[model samples]
Target: MQALLKNDVFDGNDGCQYRVVKTSSPNTGWVINLSRAHSWPVERDFGVLRSHSRVATQSTACAKLPDFAFYSEKARNRANAAYEVIKPLILNADGSENDDILDERKRNRLVLARADELDISKTTIYGYLHKWWSQGQSKYVLIPGSARNGQNQTSGTSGRGRMPGDGRYSVFQMGAEDIKRAKEFLEKRYIKKEHASLKGVHIDLIAKHYSFRDGNGDLVKRPEGEHPSIHQLRHVLKTLFTPEDVKRGKKGDKNFDRENKPMTGSSLEEAVAPGHIYELDATIFDTFLVAEANRHHIIGKPTLYLIYDRKTRLIVGFYLGLENASWTGAMLAILSLAEDKRALCEKYGHPYDPAHWPADGVFPAKFLGDRGEMASRNSDRICDGMEATISNTQSLLPITKGVVEAGFHAAHCAIKDMAPGYEPPMEAVKRRAKKYHLDAALTLEECTSLILGQIIKHNTTAMENYPLSPAQVLAGWNAIPTQLWKQELELNGCAGANYTYDYLHLQLLPRTTDDPKSKKAKVTQQGIEFENCIYKSVDDDPTVRQWMVNAGMGKSPEVHCSYDLRLVDNIIVHDSKGRTFPCTLAKDSGRFSGYSFAEVEYIIVKERRAKKLLEDKTNQAEMSRRQRAQAITTRAIAATKQAATSAARSARKADTAAERDAEKSRLRRLQTSMPPTNSESKRVGNVIALHSSDHVEGCAHQQPKIPVEDAAERPRSTIDDLLRRKAQEKTNELTHL
Candidate 1:
């Protein structure tokens, strides 16, 4: 037998359950009938309860309490307010209640006083107290039972009276036939990609079924009193369909699946330890930033790639850069997972203790991310290199990586007030004069520093709602991210794998050559060539240095190399033994020293285009000059043939050598006396005379004429003439014989 105590519920022999509201003594107490018909308590004798065999403890007799979570927030709030009214009479710090307050006479007075003070009837107060005691003394019991019982099931003016409209327009109540028609209209017209409005559908329905034709065959609308109003149609539609069903119909299946589907579980549910799962995601910062090198150059908004741990809600690593969300940015963010937190903070100018952000150099067991970057082949390389798993959420489904997605929003909100050039919301932007970009002031480095400060603050701040395990709670672990991470690591064993930066950089960063499919980068006298840039081997690596020397001797070997598109200044070269050697940009390739792979490629393309255009112009000019020279040469040959024919005709009668000589002299004098020809002048321009006596008449400029004797006075000139004369004499002798 269960001992009778205050608030103990038991089954009564009269087929009714009763609660011991107050215990006066061991054998006697005051009990209340739990039935809603009775509100007052009656005296009971516990001594006589042993005699009744049917009377036994019935704690389960009370109705099961409703889960407050299922009810609307407003209903729960109202229930709490009602509970506050009778809390003073029923509850106390100690278990015992005042005997005077429990007396029937005083209890009635108190209930009446509370009801009057709260502007409610005393019967309402009594009902509240009965429910509180009958249902395990919980405040949620006071929530209205009507919603749970499915009462008040009237719709569309059945209980709501007349709809809102002008008095001239009569309102109509929706009948069963009218509701059926409205549902048909919703399915056929309202639920579509076009998303027709409910009012439009209602009007169309009225025109189709609630209108009459006139004598001229024109359709006339029926009186407002004869058809249901749009409000009635809407109420019927809501009752027939759920919000999700309506959303699915209006937005279509794809959109409904993407945006309106219910979430089954949390991202943290599977994360058993600190580094069990890490979510990688990227978002463009809501503020514009300036270039690090040139502050006047607005770089636009930078993309922030964040890696968040699911278990501890700690920001494991992140990358902030001008690069858009791509494999390069994702790789940088992943690389930061193994970076020293102290160095990172100090470099960003936010000095902090190592313990404050202790989740450094910890690689997650699994990497989860959206499909954009994580779906690429480069991510596959991470899986193979680190021996870890890579998972991508369904396309267009970001809820799978909700932890990182929410982290981005929280980070943005945290820094919105401090960040300069922050973009206002769309509503506020309409009211502002200047655009967000125009207000840009922070450089990329400065913005990165601000973000680092926020990350440190997030890691150190206590998360009151964080779910801690029983063991963690017993071990006195707070909800701070850093503390939780450390405690989890100690209890569950570190889920992070150990890795060196050099190894991760070599394995994770992109590796490319002139040939996209080729793994080896060619070494030439110009240095190691990769993506159209030259890289020289570092001095520390003797093997790479020897390879560079061999390259100079025309015995270069193709070596494997990896590089980050974000920073092309240096690359990692894998040698024969699988050792990584650092290589830097050669001096000759200084133009691409500080540029990214994308920028270098862009500049190369532009230069190639400009060179191509210049080469085309040069080719056109060469073709024009060649044509002009050919024309001039052809005219000179024609002039020579005409001059030879005239001289031959004049010397036809002179057969002897002396006569031939006299004729040549006469022709030479005639040529000198005549003015320059038009073709000659146009071709060579006017000539200048060396002496005044040698000038010719009727010429723009005269050619200087030197006598044979003056020409023979020069030593080299006499030698050329003697050789010609001797050869002519021998020819004359041979002809005479």
Candidate 2:
């Protein structure tokens, strides 16, 4: 194995094809033969040999008996029976299996024929024959030569393997050149927005229109009809249009002028400036929800509004709560452009009277928007109102609004599909619509702010092919003015025809002892609670208070109210008193505009010393006590360590004394002497005396030492001596007799 691998015998682009055999030593009987074929011909030949011929050839002994080899009765009988059972199963010329022959009923019938008894079950016969068939018993079957032999039973085109594209449409079919040419023609003829433009019709419509007789009046083949795909159109436009065309289109509506002048012949063809066009449309937001505590229900839906902007697509205004955004809402949203300009003025401390603004101040001279009912039928009522408001700023005619009506159709086409979903719920749709409004709103305060922030981003960061954010493009325009517009601001001591600002009416708040005197509670005319609040009004006349009450500013005479309202610069209400406080303009707070929510704690964090001072003294004292406790614990730990060392030394000393005493006791016990001499002498004497006195009584060698009779006469003697004396006396009497 190692030698073959090292020689690269099996390494080839094609997989290993040749067979390798393994053997144990040189034994022929202990060999394993493995075979493989690289091609189908070789594989089929081997398969035929194994399945049909049994791979057998005649030996010399069998060759001499050729006539009898296959002619024997047993062999002929087996061949006839196999042919009868297998002839019906001969494979056809086609490469498909003979499913009918392989069916269970047919196979069962074939098996039953060979069995002599008609009653023999097909299952039993199949089992009997199948076992032998699996073991390469080919003699029990017959092989038909090739499927070609049965051509009559098969059909045309034998499924000998084939590859794709070998069939129909071999020549003269539409190819890549036709597609390329058609695309080139479309590019030259159409407008190039990602969305469909006025110039490009649906492909199906175009094809049908062109399908009519050609100039030669001959029948022409028509290509399949299709919609002009946005992808295909974009590619064609990119190839055909120059960057200048795109830049011109982006500048804005070429139809109207900033002075509300309709463009003349040349101006119609000329590019409108970037800041001249503002389109407005509304989309609903899906996720907007407002809970109604009174009804325990939610007012959840999207609302419509429009975007007001110049050609820069800077957002200038947005109107909310246009319930049923019909013609009314559309008009309202449009009208907000002037209001936005006014608000910007008041915020800048400038005269917000609409008559004072430049001709281009309010909004784009031409409005581009959807054709909702509100937008479509914008009436004299709406126009006259706008005219009256802007009459103070400029006497621009309102006819310019006509230029944007037609643009609504294009806006619908561009925006509706781009909304969140296909016919999304109104809420989501409205929100998406507001994105355009938001873009327009940014233009209201300072067009430059949006341009600097987003216009730069769109150009530098985003793909140039797509439109940049209004802010992105605006960023390149110019630095923004710091002022914002405002409206209805109360003047400082300036008397109007019927009204004037009044001194603040102070409402003393009920106080508890817990409340600090320095912290005076304040409540606005709106009944909103305020703390440490103060405001100044320009008017100090008492009649001003009566005028304010008449105008819904001061406390109601019939009903108790929290406080009386007085007007100020930007504040909705004034809170200063005339005598004790003497209303005066706040130098530091004069520019304050909107209410904002902030965390008091968060602001206090900027003053570290104040924050530390605010900490409770009790807590500080407790912390100091805890530190002292920790210090005492450190000292106690040191004392414990010293005591532990002393105890350890004392224990070691006691252990050493105990060990010494134990050793001494063991030595003393070992040194103690035994009385061996005296004990040994006594024992030896006793043993020697006992051995010499063996003839005294009942001795083996001697009869008696002291007479047995004498011993027996002494009754106090032991029983043994008495018995021995009796026996001796009897022996003596016998001798005497």
Q: What are the RMSDs of all candidates, in order? A: 20.8, 48.9
Full-model lDDT for every candidate: 0.77, 0.36
What is the per-residue lDDT of model 1 for residues 202-254, given as tens digits with 9 covering 90 to 100? 88999998999999999998987788787778787788888877888888776
Per-residue lDDT for 1-737 in model 2, tens only? 12221001122123222221111122111101112311211111222222222212221122222232334465556555654454434334474434343344565555566454546466545543342222222442222223114423322212222322645322222234433544554443333333445244435334543356779986453543222333434444464455545433433233223433444432122214432334455554322233333323334433445453322223344444415565445544555444545554455344444333322224333444434442332232323322221111112222333223222333334434433222333434565454332222111123222222232222122222223337645744221211111111111121111111121011211111122442233333322222223344345445334534443654532211122112222223333332332333344443332322123223435556676876788688889999999999999989977667535545756678889978866654444332224467577764422232222223332332555675678766598788999999999999998
TM-score of each: 0.56, 0.20
- lDDT, model 2, position 367: 41
TM value for model 1: 0.56
Task: List candidate 1 stretches off by more than 4 Å.
Answer: 1-185, 202-240, 252-264, 288-300, 349-352, 395-398, 426-428, 433-441, 513-529, 534-560, 573-590, 611-619, 632-737
Question: What's the lDDT for candidate 2?
Answer: 0.36
Candidate whose TM-score is highest: 1
Maximum-lDDT candidate: 1
